[model samples]
Target: MALFSARRGSGLAAWLLAGSLACLLLVLVDASRMAEERTRERAHGRALVARVGLTDLALFNEARYTRHLSQADRHAAFQDHPGALEHFPAGSLAGPARPSP
Candidate 1:
């Protein structure tokens, strides 16, 4: 009476096929994870660049406004004073409206 099966090759082939399938699944999962991580990093980098651009624009506008105010002033652009120069305080000249003596 034979207790064990005589065929051994078929079992080995089935095990090898299962192992290969598992390895392929793992590789595909790892590849997809790496792709998703790269996409997320790219989006973060784009947002960082946009934030920097916005900050630069805000700074440029502020500088332009300050220059316009200085040019419109009667003290800085023209270097002229109202009435007497002795009545005004020293180094405080900033606007068109003069301080009354």
Candidate 2:
């Protein structure tokens, strides 16, 4: 009876250890997946910003050309536009609508 009890305790301990390890592995996997998702989301956001910037620049250039402005002048005009400058935050990843000091 003593030997049987000892064997049973060892079996239970092994099962608990295995369950704990599996839980840890699952947590680690979930963390890794979250990290990857965040990275992809950031990349997608950058792509979108780039696309919008390019489109805005193109439209501005077309308008400038229609008004007979030189290429350099058009570039300057786009930079001087308030709406274009506010597309991104001053120094953060947040989008526009930041409160003025």
TM-scores of the models, in the given order?
0.34, 0.34
Tens digits of per-residue lDDT for model 1, 10-97:
6667667878999999999899899999999889767987877533222222233234443334544334554334223423333344
Cα lDDT listed for each candidate = 0.53, 0.52
Task: Please give the lDDT score at residue 1 for candidate 2.
Answer: 42
List model 2 lDDT by residue over 1-101, tens digit each. Answer: 45334368786777788789999999998998999999988897679868775332222323343223322333333354523542222212212233449
Model 1 poorest 10 in a row by lDDT: 54-63
Considering every candidate listed, which one attains the maximal lDDT?
A: 1
Against the correct fold, how does model 2 do in TM-score?
0.34
Off by over 4 Å in 2: 1-7, 44-101
- At residue 52, give the lDDT of candidate 1: 70
